[model samples]
Target: MSVLRSGSPHRPARSLATVAGILLALVSLLLGLPGTAGAAATQRAPEPRHPEQDWAGSQIARHEGTADGGAPPAAPLASVEGVDVSSHNGNVAWSTLWNSGVRFAYVKATESTSYTNPYFAQQYNGSYNAGMIRGAYHFATPDTSSGAAQAAYFVSHGGGWSKDGKTLPGALDMEYNPYGATCYGLSAAGLVNWMKDWFATYKARTGRDAVLYTSTGWWKQCTGNSAAFGAVNPLWIPRYGSSAGELPAGWGFHTIWQYTSSGPTVGDHNRFNGAMDRLRALANG
Candidate 1:
């Protein structure tokens, strides 16, 4: 009637309650609330969520099939391509590797405590000197005692990073190894710290950051947070399936995605790595 109170406590409380009610109404609309309000709610609701928006797993699941629903599926990522050229059997022939769509090759250099690849030195040299964009991998030393040493050994023996600054970089392979009893004993944090030490030494020697090669099990059990390693250090994730969809959500921005192990090989037993764009990027970069 006359003059309104300067600062009415009740007015503020009423305003807050009104705001809360509006928020509730909005949420109810989004959730398709029932009753007469539901019809009006639907009209003002937000757009339907994209399949890929909520979860990466869901995204992969949704896009598992070809866009046209054909039997032959398309590649998930458009940009990176890669292949692993380890000393599994023997050296990888560069010419054959290059010809078979091998863009970037991650050569296995060293393994955990006391188990080094005898062919690493020669193979690494051949790959690097032969004008191939390369990355080196140390088959993770879970035994913390020799982690730093193994890393140093890798850098010293693995031909370092490309002199021309064109290679996919280095990595620490942290998958389970059945033979190494000592390695199998360490806790997750112990394994992670060992990798950290290894990568640090490797970087110091080569002047480039090393990638962290791990599977989903290793990531969850060992590394926990994908973002814990930061954005600069590239991640090489391994998933054995038709789709790269099984990879972790935060890991969508991985540097190298090992899509398949059954890729074409070069020599009698030389298996090729996967990824076209990844290889090209490494070479060009």
Candidate 2:
């Protein structure tokens, strides 16, 4: 028989009881139970975020229209949602994007005359395989090379067109100059001529006019409000500040509008300027 150190036969039972009390206290503290030591410690609140800031790229930005806010433009200009991607987005799971309600995608194919997106094949074809209307775009560098040369390079790489009724026409991305000289050191008329030369060559090669992607401000500053491209080429305008902003001269309406860069997918968020039928018609060409 084991003798208790204290002259009490119940000493072991008392000691066990003490230990059990201590264990319960530890568990309470660990779990931050009410009236426990851990409950006294303060926890800082999470940092605040802006309406437009979606750091994870999992949430669409505020400007993206939802049913709760309002429907997209109406009638002749009602919209269907879409997106555009570049090398910056890296490799994307195209189905995930399509499931997220993206009906179309414009993948970055070429920049200037030499640079081609290494992932062009996967993005361009993957989008199609995943059931999204697909197209390619070229970032213009008119300062370093003529528009026709870049267009040629663009098409040869991945900007080519087919009458498959699922391929949207290629786009000319002539936005703010990412390189030196914002206007490419060209006068307004010179810019117009360069665009015409590129468009003309692209038409001759592909038999379809390339979409023109630009902003009202950029068009005014660089092209001197030239409406020369308004009649033929579809306009893909970017105006993130509002539902719709001033359009470039010549085009009475925009074909596509890039509303936000922080879309749930891996690209800038955009919308078709029409409903399903219109989008299908565009793809047919």
Clashes of each: 11, 0
The residue ranges of model 2 lying beyond 4 angstroms of the native Cα positions read 1-77
lDDT of 2 by residue, 1-285 (tens): 866676665634557777776776687778876533444444543333222221111122222232222232332346788888776677879889888878898988887776777777888888999998889988777876888898899889999899898899989888666444668899999999999989988888899999998877778888989989899999997766456578899998889887766655577778888897888899787
State residue 1's C-alpha deviation in candidate 1, in Å. Answer: 99
lDDT of 1 by residue, 218-245 (tens): 4665456445564556666655454434
Give me the runs in candidate 1 sitting further than 4 Å from their true place.
Answer: 1-73, 113-115, 128-131, 180-183, 224-227, 248-252, 266-285
Note the Cα lDDT for every prediction shown. 0.55, 0.76
**Whole-model lDDT, candidate 1?**
0.55
Candidate 2, run of 10 with poorest lDDT: 49-58
Q: Name the lDDT value of residue 141 in candidate 2.
A: 70
